[model samples]
Target: MAVLTASFFALLLAAAPAKAPNLAGTWRGGGFEIVLKADGSGTIKDSEYSPAEPLKWKASANALTITEEDEPVAYSFKQDGDRLHLSGGDLDEPVDLVRGAASAKASSKVDPQAAPGSAAKHVGPGSCDGACRHYLKCAGQPALQAQCVLACYSEGYGADFMGWFQSLDCVAAITVIAMLEAQSRGLQGGGGGGASQSKECEGCRWDGSSCAWYSQGNWGSNVAYSGAVITCNSSCCGR
Candidate 1:
């Protein structure tokens, strides 16, 4: 009986997971930053938007749970050397974080003449410049197109716009230009015809207008505009 009890205890010990690493530090990536404390609390700072939010956090063997305003958000994490990879939670894409202090030290070692966020220092005249010109032509209005291109370029390549432009091949440049053009026009293609519509018309009755599209629902049950024949799913159109 004692031998059996000892064997059971040993199995339980073997099954227990290892302790999680201490995550008390500043982690920065994805244009946002997180500061964790030893007391299982943290704040998330969005560099492009709002101020930091205070949250309570709990760490498990392989995951971390954070609670904000009574809602809990969870993320699975793994650390490899100096880098930490986090997935799930509110993130649409996986976030890679580097220790803030270490990142600064590494940045100091880089060449001054090279652009901050881009690899290649100089690109020939035709690369990104050609792409930008093509984007302007496809984008219509000059003022709005310029704004969209600048925003997209800044986001994709960081502050060193010239260096980043140099790094892109013809295909990549064209793709970026197309994306910016679409963004400026507020047209997200896919789904049924006229998939792009104003958000204000979601629940409201679609008055007959060129910008209006049919809301998703049982066919023949309801119709928005007369003679409109497109059927969109609820994912894109409102019921």
Candidate 2:
């Protein structure tokens, strides 16, 4: 049924007329607002709160050949469905469709250079202060992010819908490395014997390259082993 419907729509397009690119709607970007009216005219407002100025554009490919009244002309645009990448002057932001849509928020790792300023950008204005869902811990271990999306309908499926997320604890992971590290340091002082020079250089020193049980670091072995701890040298007496 879906395929047939798509085919029917394709057939209609084959019979429809090809005319000017009718950009009659509201298009929004990072910090800019554009409104295309039915009268074939439009107005663009910059998002950075520049002086309210009129904009002139020529539709060539699939975007408006925008000309801002702020010197530095010549803007390039490429269209992908409901998104437009437009740039001229210092404006390097894209225009998106966000009119008549439900309130939606997306988490993004913002670049420092792109924000109003740096330093205070981490926890200051416009900064997301709450714990991020990506690395948030529910309990001792890792927590599972559960979400319950709620959608609303109007008179016979009206023009308003919504969705949300609810998090839940799913699994717990084992993390005892701190305790193990402490225990390993305590065992280093016991006098086993004159130890061979450690050759495992990849990570911490190991007993041998092929062995997984890594040897411990001699934090206090010098005092405990005293004469037992021989000065290490490669190619010993017996090799």
The lDDT leader among the candidates is: 1
Model 2 scores what on Cα lDDT?
0.33
lDDT of 2 by residue, 1-239 (tens): 99999999999998887666655566654434567666645675432222234556556444455554343255566655555556543332432333323102210222212221111111211101111121122222212323200111111221111000001011110111222333344346345333312331122222332322232322221211111111222222222
How many pairs of residues collide in model 2? 7
TM, every model: 0.41, 0.30
lDDT of each: 0.51, 0.33
User: Tens-digit lDDT track for model 1 on 1-239?
Assistant: 99999999999999988877777888766444678888888886533232466778878877988796577989999986566788888554576677768856654443332213221223433233433433343333333546656665565544344445434322333444443444335444433245344432233343443233332332221322121222223333344
Model 1 TM-score relative to the real fold:
0.41
- Candidate 2 accuracy as TM-score: 0.30
In each prediction, how many residue pairs overlap at the backbone (N, C-alpha, C within less than 3 A)?
A: 0, 7
